[model samples]
Target: MQIRKKIYWSLCVLLLAACRQSPPPSRPNPVLQLREMGQLATTEYELSKVVRARDEATWYKIGERRMLVSCRARIKAGIDLSQIRDIDIQAQGDKISIKLPAPQILTFSIPPENIRVVYSDVGLFRTPFSQAETNAIMQQAEKQIRRQADSLNMLQKAQEGAAVFVRNFFEQAGYKEVTITYRYQENAS
Candidate 1:
């Protein structure tokens, strides 16, 4: 009877081991493809120049009609430049286009017609610096830039985490084709 009990216990242990699930098989990471819709051109225009009224009794209209002018200029100028023309995302034979809304002027303190100008001089240092020091500084900056780029990549993965998981699961299940489309919502004013 003891030997029979020992054999029964051994059989139970074997059955338990056999019923246990094996660890899931690992696979190579998926590569993401990013495509740019078009180059975003930045255009700046000087809306107006205005003069400030120091005294409260001044007869000048508080907010008067202003002249509006627009001309093509380099993006480096300090002007009111705000616009995003085109953006698109594509993945696994599916494409999604993102449309950015127009920017609105939230607040303005300067009068429309008065001429108020402010300028600052930007000077470059004439003294020569060592190449080694410059290279070191650039290396540090490059490291920081790479870290930011990695963070952005991680954020993109997180944003598409569910889709990625689904795709991976389907692939593991022997499905060949899977696609996802993402759309942007326009803001209501």
Candidate 2:
């Protein structure tokens, strides 16, 4: 009985030890990959433009509906740092040359809270504007803002800022001479 008790206790201890294993390694968070790679987006243009869009439709030449919405869209244009590869950053002695991605619009926002309705018109014969109609106006307003993006010089500004950013970044890495150039792409704006 004493040998049997000792054998059962040993088996129980062994079973408990077998059930315990080392914890698995933690995975790296994908959201922090860019930061881990030392790449940072440098937005140089935060342009706010007020746009006006008019939607009109005529039915049977006797009924017509027209809508004009004036709103402001905030545009942020910059280069995506995540596109940078290790090969793009070439450092030879004190000089560093980096080929950066083309500048693009990072974010376009027209917050409902920020959009002020300057004027809303409904013709006498036309019905009041529905939710769909209002949403359409906002979308049109966004398009107008995009069309005027070049006129606002956002692309140039973003590229210039990105160059400065990369130069500064390399400078911190002990590079004295920094040359930053953009990799041109077709239809890039």
Candidate 2 Cα errors over 4 Å, as ranges: 1-40, 44-68, 123-125, 185-189
Give me the candidate number with maximum TM-score: 2
- lDDT of residue 47 for candidate 1: 32
Clashes of 1: 7
Per-residue lDDT for 1-189 in model 2, tens only? 999999999999999989967899999777744434333445644445454544464444444445555555666777888888897788889998888888887777777776656666666666777888778777777776677766877778888888987788889989999988887842254
Q: Lowest summed-lDDT stretch of 10 residues in model 1?
A: 71-80
TM-score of 1: 0.20
Pairs with backbone N, CA or C atoms under 3 Å apart (clashes), candidate 2:
none
What range of 10 consecutive residues in model 2 has the weakest lDDT sum? 32-41
Residue range 1-189, candidate 1, lDDT tens digits: 999999999999999888967899999898668743332222222232222212123355342222222111111111111333334323343323333333222222222233222322222422232445334443444344444433333323332443454456556766566553333323342
In model 1, residue pairs whose N, Cα or C atoms come closer than 3 Å (at least 3 residues apart or on different chains), thus clashing, are 49-114, 49-115, 50-114, 50-115, 50-116, 51-114, 51-115
